[model samples]
Target chain A: MTAQPRIVEVRQKVLRRNDVLAGELRDRFREAGVYVVSLVSSPGSGKTAFLEKILTMMGRQARIAALVGDLATDNDAVRLARAGVPVRQIVTGTVCHLDAVMVQSALEGWKLAELDYLFIENVGNLVCPSSYDLGENLRVVLMSVTEGEDKPLKYPTIFNGADIAVVTKIDIAAAVEFDWNAARANIQAVRPEMEIFRVSARSGEGLTEWLASVESRRAAKNRPG
Target chain B: MHELSIALSILEGAAEEVERQGGGRVYAIHLKLGSLSGVAKDALIFSYKLASEGTPFEESRLVIDEVPVVVFCPECRAERRLSSIQQFCCAVCGTPTPDVVRGRELEIAGLEMDV
Candidate 1:
């Protein structure tokens, strides 16, 4: 008789290692009382511009640091450092998304407890970044007015994965004929009750409310039980 | 693409599982892939070939089961599977649902091996 092959049951999540590392990173962030926020979006969605605004505004109230990831170049890092905060660039080389290990390695010489807010700017991509969690307390997904309003519906995975959504380039919304109500409705349809913020980094229209909200959330997270 | 990284992870996991089984040659790896997992099946398959080269999984075949998006409907009080990812509402009651019951899976379910 011919030999029979065996079938073995091995139920294991493929990303288990990353998940475990992310859990450790989360615990570390919690212990240090550092509020980590990450930004994700498609290219040219003004993530860097918005982050620059946030760093400038919130830096006055807290000690902030930024780590930006890109396939190549430290352009974003240099630009963000102009805000006069500690900034580092994690050049991912060929990696499309940033994983927990990358974030952990990028934070090698830094002390988490010395900072209030740590911002991670993920490589600009809506699809791949949704699958990787970088151990951030707040994950912000952004879309610019220049992109389609149905962007949320098109990439619902990212929208669902994010804690908040930010609509960037609002100052040029009128000029671009961006449909404001449609965008809001699309976001609502995808995530039901997701918190959304509209801001113009150029004109600083909605910076106050956004900054105040971040401060309050950071404060609340650090509050004793 | 990120599929290469995913394929590499799969190879590592599969190798460990095979080794844990007290030595075997893997013939096929069965995977459960959900559309919401953000992985392109064709790309992953292509990348798997590159990732498995010169490894124990070099000759293994990837058998994928595509899982459709399923969500819990509060209005219907039941879980419904959607025909398409674009339809986020309950297939039965048609109410919008953010409570996903199933999908978003990326796991190796089983392996066919020669002992």
Candidate 2:
């Protein structure tokens, strides 16, 4: 008699474990009243620069701390710590993105309640970072003027997943001849009704509005539910 | 690429399924690959081979079912398959669709095994 092959139905999500952990982290963040924000962008999108500026601007008032992810170096961690806020580096080694477990582990020995705002700077990749949820209340995706206007269209998944979009390097937007209308149109096309913030880390323009918006949103999230 | 990590997760998931099935050797794994899942099919197949090494799945095959992106348009009140990833607007009314009804799947559909 011939041996028969068995077919077993699995129907399981591949990243379900990460999703569960991220849910737990979200609960923990909510209970502790610590608002978490994460940043995602392609490399050289001025994410670190903008984060540095934000930390410098709101660190004292918000009691903010940060955790930055990269493929190899602690360079971002080092640079962000210079703003005098507690910063940790999650070195992903060969991984292209940061998962919930990595974030939970990197936050070892730290009290989430003690920190009002915790920022997670994901590995600088627009594609992979969108797939993993790191339990952040606000997920901000960045695009620099130098990266072209159609970036949001090219990576719609990332844009669709983000709560807010930030346009960086606006100080040189005129010098680069960045098309404001085209950029806004493209972002709107991919994600209609998306809130976008334009800022320049060098001149610090638009930082106050961004900070105020973040503060208001965080307050909204902290409302008794 | 993150495909390797995804491949690892698939293997882990498949192994658990295999164990729950009262012990069997997995011959092939079936997966649903979606357009909006942000996973490359060819890259995932290649990574699966590398990740399966030295494990029971070393000789197993990965069979992926490619799923097309499907979005629902509230204006049109219809769900349509996306012809292009760049164009998310409804095929009927041309209104942009923010509701994705399908094509974000990244899951192990089933397993072919010998009991």
Candidate 3:
């Protein structure tokens, strides 16, 4: 037998499989004209409440749906479904974060082609979610003002992974002694070019601008190059 | 934690590679972990053992290379290795770097085997 070095210079990424699946999902989302917005944040950072408001607000303009992920409990799904949109709960069964496989499975049996907007609420953790690609067109990482300004510094990876950083609960920023400027600076320190959105899901402050940003991005992608 | 999910993916990737190679059991998986990979090595070590249970990768060793985060100082036009992952400031110039030339990766770069 000829000696052929079985060692192949693959140069393939470790998450190559997930990347492939995510690409396919992206194509599916593009073809269906569905704009997917994924939310990720640490526990109790108001990710659920934020999505609830989003679903409630966007309920008038278009058809919307959501998939919520958690290690346990279907509470968020219940809350979001109150907006009169179809919501699916993905109980991760002990996994700390949702991966591409979980996202792909959640898409099954659903007519993605029919939906206008799809939102995925990730498990309440910053670290793990950063590593997984959940096939989303937009990944919005939320940080409530109640959290520390050093949040982006400590959890740099999660902040860096996000396309946009949403500072939530601005209504209580001062009451909670939250330093808004420092938080923005901290995020910029970690990811210099990341978009910033100061939103109060409860007060509806900054929601219109946030929604407009999402719409413009969707419109931009739909535009021919 | 998320380490379990990452460990699962690592095992799956290694298994697929091993199967395609005809015959060999994975003895160990080598991962080049950059300082900015966001993975705490100690935590991954603990999670890897737990994730490998009842799977083809059971009993396989995990070898990790601690790669230092290196960046190019745009101001000074010099490449420097970060003293720590948390410390992104250039050592010599003390300038904030614009691009991440190396570091911040979660990759299964290589694998050891028994054919």
Candidate 4:
């Protein structure tokens, strides 16, 4: 009896192509001098609220644009546009995450050269968004004070990919008895050196510092080497 | 919840692969899904059946190799597979936070088909 011949040595990455496209898009964003930032958080974590306030504060100085994704509805974009910033809505029919392809599609008619800051608010899904890259310079993961502090531990992948963490709705922290210390501890446990901002979009607290940080980062990127 | 979409993508990719490698019916698909991938194996299995309906992979079975989360213990200077993402620390030495060495993968290894 002849032994059956077996062939091996097929090394393939299913998502390697997507990662390549994401790298290309990152290069495009950098070359255009656009500070691309993406936001990821759970449902109703006040992403829109925080973004609206930030956009309003960043008017004139920065030509800011936003792309908000949801499972349905253009409500977030509509709400965000009232702040006098160019905001677009991406309705991902049945998708759970915003991948690189979606970001590429979202920038179809967008003039990247005209914008200083471009914020892409991913679909409100902690689990799905972490697996996909949207070609952003920074991925900001937001966690509201009302949510359990253990969210960082529950969704460590999201936290780990994030460049910074924004603790939203801090004004109501005491009302909800939110463990700010535990929240900080959880985030620090997962990402030791991640920059964190405790901001209240409603009360306008910590807005200056957050705005300053954004400006500093953008300025540092534009520095002559 | 997004398992159906992932399953559909898997079937679509596998079908294309099989068609490119001559005409053959897919028998099975091997997947490596880590514990920290945020994808439930059972959910993907349940969705695979629905997604494969009327597709080239209609009769294929999904065999998943679940990988545990592995972390590097700075204290012990060793890598260990973690039981859970919540407790991603050293098994011994009571280390608080360690770097995640592995286990956040969700990939389709390959497809098996009758040539």
- What are the Cα lDDT values of the candidates? 0.89, 0.91, 0.82, 0.82
lDDT per residue for candidate 1 within A58-150, as digits (tens), equals 777789999999999999999999999999999999888999999999999999999988999999999899888788999999999999899
Question: Distance (Å) between predicted and true CA of B69, model 4?
Answer: 2.2
TM-score, prediction 4: 0.89
Query: Could you tell me the lDDT of residue B76 within candidate 4?
Result: 87
Clashing residue pairs, candidate 4? none
Q: For model 4, what is the error of residue A95's alpha carbon versus the real structure, in angstroms, after optimal superposition? A: 2.5
Tens digits of per-residue lDDT, candidate 4, A90-127, equal 99998888888888988898889999999999999888
Which candidate, 2 or 4, has the higher DockQ? 2
Q: What is the iRMS for every candidate structure?
A: 1.5, 1.4, 3.8, 3.7
By DockQ, is 1 or 4 better? Answer: 1
For model 2, the docking class works out as medium
Q: Pick the candidate with the highest lDDT.
A: 2
lDDT tens readout by residue for model 4, B25-92:
66788888877676778999999999888876777789888888778888888987665566656777
The best candidate in terms of DockQ: 2
lDDT of 2 by residue, A1-225 (tens): 857888788899999999999999999998888999999999999999999999999977888889999999999999999999999999998888999999999999999899899999999998898779899999999999999999998898888788899999999999889998999888877776778999999999988999899999998977778
True contacts kept of 1: 0.72
Rank candidates by TM-score, best first.
2, 1, 4, 3
Residue lDDT tens for model 2, B44-93: 99999999999999999999999987889888788988777777778778
User: Candidate 1: what lDDT?
Assistant: 0.89
For candidate 3 chain A, which ten residues in a row score worst on lDDT? A2-11
> CAPRI band of model 1?
medium
